[model samples]
Structure formats: structure tokens, C-alpha cells
Target: MNILITGSTGMVGKNLINHNNAKEYSISGPSSKEINLLDKSKILDWLAKNPTDLIIHCAGLVGGIQANINNQSGFLFNNLQMGINLIDAAYKSGIRNFINLGSSCIYPKNISNEIDESMLLSGKLEETNEGYAIAKISVAKYCQFLSEKGFNYKTIIPCNIYGKYDDFSETGSHMIPGVIARMHKAKINNDNYIEIWGDGKARREFMYAEDLADAIWFCVKNIKQIPKFINVGIGEDFSIKDYYQTISEIVGFKGEFKFNRTKPVGMKRKLICSKIINQLGWMPKFSLNKGISYTYNYYTKEIQN
Candidate 1:
């Protein structure tokens, strides 16, 4: 099948493109400069010329907690606009298969339990990333509305992901990559200590990006059987301190970590229920340590050099 993966240069998109099964189909991964999703006309024009049969919508404005807090408006507006434009263009172009990527952040903030797909928007979102969550929820709802009308658009909500091509910048990266970068720098500079935001007690479920790519491909092969919304995750979680310890081990950082209680830790816990996807015969291949090791290796080889 002919497939178009938005945000092809992103960590997730790049992983999907590099998946072994990707060779079985014709896939187009256009850069933002090649096809700007913020513009509807540009999307429609691209579809008109590309003749795509499926779309894996992975494009969005995403970042860590500080970035989310500082750029709430940009996150909401850009993400919402990009999703709407792409989905609308896909509809107009008669494309039936679409796989929209959603984050675990879409679940309510107060729920400390393993989040299921049904609990989406059940309560207030965590204040730190509420804008981004709202945008993701809105787009997922849009896809659901279209799915009810017979289109095969579906949303796959994955937990925190880190792997090759992850954003490891100081202010623009998620927990895993951010920690990796910080710890690596501290190790390199022979810093005696590293500071962690919050009390380092909040829990999170993170999967390797390549594992998410495998799940997406599984969804592609079983598109008709996939639900309107499904959760794809590692079915496990770790405290911030635990993650710090693990990543430190991988990065060979021997420094002590100090916690800053004043920093905003978005949610106390955000672990999603991956029962449906699990039953669908899809499971993540990497453990937390294993994934971090791979990601750290990628960091050293790709980003550090």
C-alpha cells in the first residue's frame, strides 16, 4: 500500500520508516518544508499530487514540561491546526486509512491508576501540559467522529517514548532523553551532582520508539480490527528517581542527584492500560534498561558526535 507518514523526520516517524516491515510497502515521509501541515491548501495540494492510500499522522508540537508551560498557546494552536488540516485533507482526498498518534498525557491528570482508553477526558488534565493534552484530545475526537462515518482513522495513545532521534535539547526534550543529555553532560564535565526537577517521585510509563513503530505497523496490518482508540504501552512504570538511577547507570554518571521540590512535575503517575493492544498480539520488545541503553548509545553516536 502507499503510505504517507507525517513528521517523517521525527523520532517516531524515523523509527517507523526504518522498521523492517516498511520495506513491504511504498511509504512517503515528507519533511515539514515539503508539506506544511499547518496550511490546509498545502496539504490538499500535496495529497492531490501524491496519491497516498494511508496516513500515519505523527506531526505535532511536542516538548518537555517547561516547554509546555512556557509555550502553551503554541502547543495547542499548532497541534490542533496541524491535525485538523491533515485529517480534513485526507477526507477530501478520499483516503480511508489514518493512524493518529496520541500521547498518554491525554488521560486525566488526577487518576493515579493505569489509564484505559475510556478514561480519556474523564477529569481535568494536569495543569502543566493541559494545553497540549486538549489539542491531542480534540484531534482524537475528530478522528473518532470520522471513524463512526466509516473512515478507518484511529488513534494510538502511547506512553512516554524515547529512542533514536529523540530531542535531547536542554529545554525541548522529554524525561528520558533530557535526563540522558543532562547526565552525560554532567559526567563529561565531572560535575559532582545533578539536579532533578520535582521530588523525583512522579511515575511514568515509557516505551522505546522502535517498539511503538512496531505497534503502528501491527495496526496497519490489522486496520479493520483496530478500535477507534487504542493504548499502546509497556504496561509498566517507574518513578522519576528510578528512571534517573537507571539512566545514570547507562550514561555512567556517578554523581549524586538533588531534588528540587519547587519545580512543576506535571502528573504524579501516568501509566496506560495496554490490554487491548496486548491482546491484539502486540508487545513492546525492550525493557526500560534496555531501551535506555539503546537511546544512550544513539545519543553518544548521533547527537553527541
Candidate 2:
């Protein structure tokens, strides 16, 4: 099988490429420099030449809270355009198998318990990242629309993910990487205190990037018919305080942290309801601590080089 993976250098796409062990499939991952996702002509041309039997669409404009607030239009436009172009191109190319990635942020902001796939679009999105979530929701709807016409598009929604190749930007990264980056920099600079936003009570469920990749591959190889939307995660969560403590220990940061109550905590809790996906016999292999340790080691090596 010939497969094409967009966003090849991204956290999720990189893990997907690295962990794919199916000897029967040939995967092609294209970088942004090679094909601009916003350019429909380029996408069409690339697909015409690539001759892929399957396409894994992981490319998107993504970042943390600050970036999302500052670049709302950019997030919405770029992500929506990319999804529309790729799915249309795949449709034109007659590729039957396509996987669309969605964010758990697509859920409503007030959800504090386990989130099931049925809860999507039931309420308003979190205002901070509403633009990005709208784009993702649109893509999922489009896929659903196309499925009725005989297209085999699968949408997998994952909770907050972290691991190697994550964007560690201090101002524009997700929770795990952002915390690690700040704490690591503080430790390296011999800073005495690391400030955390909120009261450290916000809890989140995070799946390692490799585990998400593994889930995707498992879907590709084992499942005969992928659901319209499925949740992939570890099915458990921990408080922000625990995450900080764990990551700080892994990075050897001895300093304490001060929580700023004025800043946003994003969500109170984000646990994945993995009943459907779990029934498929898919389970995450990495524990929170183990994943953090692995990611910290990679981050340290990266900074030294």
C-alpha cells in the first residue's frame, strides 16, 4: 500500500512515520516546504504525482493559548483550507482510505467528566481556542458528509498529547511541553521559582504521541470499518500540580512553582471516554511518568545540540 502523511515533521506525524512497522505499506511524508497545504493547486499537483492509496491528514495550524488568542484568524483559515483541500484532492484522486485528525478541544468547555464522541457539537466551544476548534469541527462534518457518498474517512479525536518532537515554545505550546520548556529553562538558568498558571487544580488526560500513532496504525491494519469519530487516549487524568511535579523531577528542576490564579486554567478536567476505541482492543502503552521521562531526555539532548 502507498500512503501519504501530511505534516510529516509535526509531533504526531513524525511519531506516525517513525513507529509504522507495516512492511507492506510505503509511506510518503511531505514537509511544508515541499507542498504548501494552503495552496490547493499545489496539493492537487502533489496528489496527482504521489499516487497514494491512503492519506493520513495530520497537518494543521496549532499552538498554545497565547498563540491561539493572538492568531485566531490564522488558525481558522489555514486549518480549514488545508483540510478542505486535502480531502477534496483525495476524493478526486479516488483514494478511498483517509484519516482526519481532530482535537479534544472540539468538545465543550464546561465538560468536566469523561467525554464521549456523542458530546461533540452539543454546546459552545471553549472561547480561547474556539476558532481552531471550529475548523476541526468543520473538517469532521465534511468527512461525515462525504462518508454518505461512499468515502471511507475516519476521524480520531485525541486528548492533549505530548512527547518527542512536541513544540516546546514557552508562549505557544500545549500544557505538557510548555511546562517542561519553562521548567527546563528555569533549571538551566538556575532560577529559583517557576510560575504556573491557575491554581494547579486543572486536570488533563494526555496520550503520548507514539501511542496515538500506534492507534492510527492499528486502525489501518485491524479495523475493517472505522467509525465517523472515535476517541483515542489513556482514559485517565492527573492534576496540573502532579504533572508539574513529575516533569520537574524528570528535568531535574529543584525549584518550586507559584500558581497565578489570575491566568486561565483552560479546562477543569479532560478525561477521554475510551469505551469505543478500547473495545477495539487498543490501549496506550506508556504511563505518564514514563512518557515524561522519555520526552525530557529527548528535550535535553535537543537543547545541548
Output candidate 2 Cα RMSD: 1.3
Distance from true location, Cα of 8 in model 1, Å: 0.1
After superposition, candidate 2 runs with Cα above 4 Å error: 20-22
lDDT of 1 by residue, 1-305 (tens): 99999999899999999999999999999989889999999999999999898999999999999999999999999999999999999988899999999998888886878899999877888989888999999999999999999999999999999999999998889989999999999999999999998999899899999999999999999999989999999999899999999998889999999999988988899899999999989988999889999999999999988
Residue pairs in clash, model 2? none
Count of clashes, each model: 0, 0
List TM-score per model, in order: 0.99, 0.96
In order, candidate lDDTs are: 0.93, 0.87
| For model 1, the run of ten residues with the poorest summed lDDT | 104-113
Using alpha carbons, what is the TM-score of model 2?
0.96
* Candidate 1 Cα errors over 4 Å, as ranges: none
